[model samples]
Target chain A: MNIRYPNGTAYHQSAKRPATTMSQTTNYGDRGMSLEAELNESNQYYLNQGVAVIHKKPTPVQIVKVDYPKRSAATIKEAYFRQPSTTDYNGVYQGYYLDFDAKETKNKTSFPLKNFHAHQIAHLRACVAAGGIGFAIIRFTDDVATFLLPASFLFHCWDDALQTDGRKSIRRSAIEAHGYQINPALNPLVPYLNAVDQLITATKK
Target chain B: MNIRYPNGTAYHQSAKRPATTMSQTTNYGDRGMSLEAELNESNQYYLNQGVAVIHKKPTPVQIVKVDYPKRSAATIKEAYFRQPSTTDYNGVYQGYYLDFDAKETKNKTSFPLKNFHAHQIAHLRACVAAGGIGFAIIRFTDDVATFLLPASFLFHCWDDALQTDGRKSIRRSAIEAHGYQINPALNPLVPYLNAVDQLITATKK
Candidate 1:
């Protein structure tokens, strides 16, 4: 299975975090922005410049219990994943539809399939089938290299690894072969739309 | 001008408090879920059922400064709105590409147009011109109603409001006349597809 993570950075933070009621004082959105926040800023830049329409998909949440601590009652005691989602960000660019996931990895060498679940792969597959442009933005924070990889490549890596689990990660070299490297700048940390243009160009050729 | 909340029980605290950082945490998915969360769940459910292939359009975020709370900084100290979004959700369903927004209001009588930005209305017009299904989900919490108002209805309201500082809200009566009411259900509270079916059916006649 050929999986690729440019430089390999942390993509998605772990699903679990410190309990909100336990010691939930930190306002993460106000201080630490997620990939969603960054991409949102980038999308705004693109919109102002008339580049593209892109957005982060909201995390799927299931509500279980509500405590209503103070008339607001209904606090969630427990609820779990309905299923893993397809991609992170997606929208329209130059009249063509686009979809992709942004992931960060602490691992410097490669990106693991563990990062993507089976349902998500199925989703990407369906998106591609529907004639949408699908890809991923992989960040290797250690080296600060982000690459845009096509969904097809993701599909291959995902499918192959199902049988044998040794080469579970997509190496840097494989990423170079199939993905485009994106450099961070003032806006669109991963200026992925450029890669999207190249992808559209390459596909046309 | 018209809009309607066919499904009683607008978006409410269906989501248990205080709210988790990520993931759907309970059996109740729509109530507590943010507008974005509900759309994604519905989109995926639609995609799986072969009903539609819609997605949430990402917001444009402007990242001003990245605060290094620590070596592994998880805080975004400064940021601002970069660009206005065109729409909240868009996708291809039943051969027709659709775009819309899902909003909830504590008010029961009318939905405030102020809730809708100028750019979203512009985007919806363009989408309608391009031959896509464009509408909005207005959840009136006080009345426990949700309406699938056509984009045209919103434009009319917007235009009228411009004429007079009279009001910037969509009256419930107008919504009832112009928009189709969505009956809430367990599977898809916003079973907009059924409404789409009726719209398609009406268009044929």
Candidate 2:
């Protein structure tokens, strides 16, 4: 089906339909959507269900000039993208502050640490220190497998990367061992909050 | 002295220095800044002190066209402002999810309900429902007084406004009765977190 996102991007959903009557077991795969698009759809589902209140922050832009015509809406004539100072997505979930960024990599064996910015890591560290739950939602595009890595683990790996003899990227095996795997589902696409519940319970312990 | 904001707006701090040696007794007043500027300064102070991790979401804009010249960054040629779907500011403070927006009005007797958009009210209601502390920092520009009105009280006022015979605005007297007043300070500009601590204590009660 043809769909248009709020930003006016044209998206086409996969036409392949499940043959059986069972809907719960149906896997949607990636469905030709970016990781961000999937997360947006998932966040919308959660909002509608009153399960949580999360949203992806808009891309920051620096506007240099605008044209205000007498009878029309003001139009930005010159602008440029600006580096964000925090994670891409953050909100409240069941009295816990949720903060995270989504990253996708095509590498089959590892997720590169260079995908994250220094400011984002600092911001997440600050959030975690202030008693908020922070994490990274990583997707391996080769197989569409996703994982939620807690900020504490990410911080350890990040600090290791800064060491003189540390490896450049985190190994997939290490991520699978330390992170919570989030399987793609029929509803909410990426059911990551189920994993967040685990993190909260573990934190309490 | 002329100071430039990240957005390139020039701001001038009041040159008149506080004569008293007691800094705690010093009131900075508005300091010739917008309510947003004061809040930004306060949030920075909190961040530096590791007290809270709050941030104002960037203004959303819809980009229609862009031009990418060689050897330089891409420039937005056409764009328009998009209405935000949530509160302007949110973060975690002492294990509690805090969500709020800042508003200013010059009215001497009452604060007009028209200053708020329906989506903002709905968003605050949803955040509060999700067990987050939601509020609005309202500044009366007439006397430079500010107050923090809780989402529960705002919901009452919003619903009352919807009634056929209800008043369209909240009187200053009513706000002073229900909301916590925030006095300006030299360190953070707006020492609003003291008021927030009170809100948390009351919530626990």
Candidate 3:
């Protein structure tokens, strides 16, 4: 039977699709693949190299109905996405607790503040308060440029946006001034850890 | 349409069941509640009090089909469990990364090693290597006694079990000797963090 995803797109069952084929299908010249896919591949590379232990939290779903054909396996027949209360990814890296989310926008001039939710900002604030490193990986899809924006810098912009009639989105110039640029690599597509190392060094200073 | 769970129990659509009634029906006299439920409640308490920010990762499911009947809410029509590569819960607490799994067994004298998968053990080992705290909160269902067993001790037992003709499960006496016993309380319900505090102190030494 035909099915649909939450976004109203038709769900195509790609059970037999090879991993290499899926990666090859991305329009690399313009988009260079999705930010999420790049991060996942980079994380796998880091894991294989024994550099870090990071993982994306699974999407939260509320199961309403399930079917059991036998005793060993059960098939979920009804479920919906539950709003998540935390960031997308979190894990231990080089004896540090890292919490962050990745976002992509086709907008060339600025990264819109609407990409973040109040609850997620609150969570990042709490993480920082508890001494964990919190940051955002913002990707300007138009230029394939990504920046590791520290939570503190984001928080400042968020509060400023609320108090004044200023721009709600962070300008590209401001992000370049405050955030560290992450260079893409062959082995690890998005070498975010290098930006994280800079974050740690800056924190120490 | 009727459905069943992996345990062969029919899934009763409890859309209208009151929360209080569900908690009351758990046969609380002999067994207070499932270890998972108690931990979730305790985690909520911790969050409410600003004590810690720990959360259980949602159960992972591989969705094969989803139906949008009227183009509003999507219902999963076919999904199955995916083997989890990490522990059930992980979060940052007081600057430390904590990862653990809660397990319950009716066996009074020993906690079977079979309850843990090789992948989980490997994941825990990796977490420890990355400088995060890894552990198991084991509940002896018969006596309702729970202990915080360190992953280091668990690793030793796992390696020894494979190498020799030794008991595959940890003996009650051994756990009592090596693990920190967690006392349940009213507010936090599972008071496991106090045991965690002790674990942290010992790590410092």
Candidate 4:
């Protein structure tokens, strides 16, 4: 029943922040909240306000053994991951099936291609083919900046990596040009949905 | 990482059945494939054909202990469910956010309301309010029949339970009248999406 991080830190839901100009004074990296945590909180806000119905898919685990110590409670004794997951988050937005993964990188110049897996790439491709909106939310942790990179552009980079012995990362410059930059806000925090709106508009063209 | 069921049976992906009318000869329940498994196969079929993108959310497990004997593999030693989950499956289908759960019951006359949790009902309501398509796929195991019951109708029944205290379960006659019956098939197995199409059309009307 008690959930903790690998380091044994108890995982408490992130506290709601005041909608004010605390961004200049507060160091977000030092705030102890991860990009995933912030996104979850923002999704909660969206859900509560009837704006969107998005959710982070749970980490899939294959249960091996269960101990029924009591009739009421059964505890899992052993398990392992079934496979590498497809994406971190997916749901409906304005009748669009949105599929995306959020990744944080310390590298300043480029987002490493190695951060993505083949399975995830394939899953995104499949989603896009099925008329779903697919993208990656890349957060350059060092600069506290994030970009919403469309899956179409990402596939191009992925294929380019396979065809040639070029850099295995999408350069920061390329991301800035092709992806929509997401500014942090008080209420929604990342406000990545704004970027999604732009992407939807761009697709219409 | 071998996975076996609680009864110590080895887990195997449900085999693709031949396109034959074996319903009269073959006993599906005895074939060891649960309704969930059938739906998974059907979803896989949909994915393979580039029809729609749907996935069953993985069961959320709160890991209490993990053994990292090797750097490559980590085995969860102890864990438990954090909370009751929302629904079994959710994804985007042809520009619609599809959210639903699959349930099977032994009762012949009615599909018991007790099969659904309060949290799931609330989750469905929230999804529907956010413009997502929500429903339940109820299977009568006695007759081997499945029906898609829309969230709108489900909410009415849920509220009726609270107010009038009528029969807690939806009578089989009511489900037949309000819900779309899904005929089992070879390629998609359950072919529930056909029922989804019906639901979509009904909503349009």
Candidate order by DockQ, decreasing, is 2, 4, 3, 1
Candidate 3 ranges with C-alpha deviation above 4 Å: A1-32, B1-31, B69-71
Model 1 per-residue lDDT tens digits across residues B44-143: 6777776557766444444444445556623334444345556767765544556788888887677888998898887777666645667888877564
lDDT of 2 at A180: 93
True contacts kept of each: 0.03, 0.79, 0.62, 0.74
* RMSD (Cα, Å) of model 3: 8.2
Tens-digit lDDT track for model 3 on A1-205?
4432232122133455433334423334233367898899888888788888888888888988878887678888888878899999888888888999999998999999999999899889887887789999999876688999999999999897887786799999999999999977787999999999999999999
lDDT tens digits by residue: candidate 4, A62-116 = 9889998966677999899888457879877777889999999999999999999
Q: Specify the CAPRI tier of model 2.
A: medium
- Scored by lDDT, the top model is 2
Docking class of 3: medium
Per-prediction DockQ comes to 0.07, 0.67, 0.52, 0.58
**Clashing pairs counted in every model:** 58, 0, 0, 0
Q: DockQ score for model 2, please?
A: 0.67
Off by over 4 Å in 4: A1-30, B1-25, B28-30
Candidate 4's DockQ = 0.58
Top-TM-score structure, candidate number? 2
- Select the stronger candidate by DockQ from 2 and 3: 2
Question: Which predicted model would earn the best DockQ?
Answer: 2
Instruction: Score every model by TM-score.
Output: 0.58, 0.88, 0.85, 0.86
Q: Give the Cα-based TM-score of candidate 3 against the true structure.
A: 0.85
Worst 10 residues of 3 chain A by lDDT: A3-12
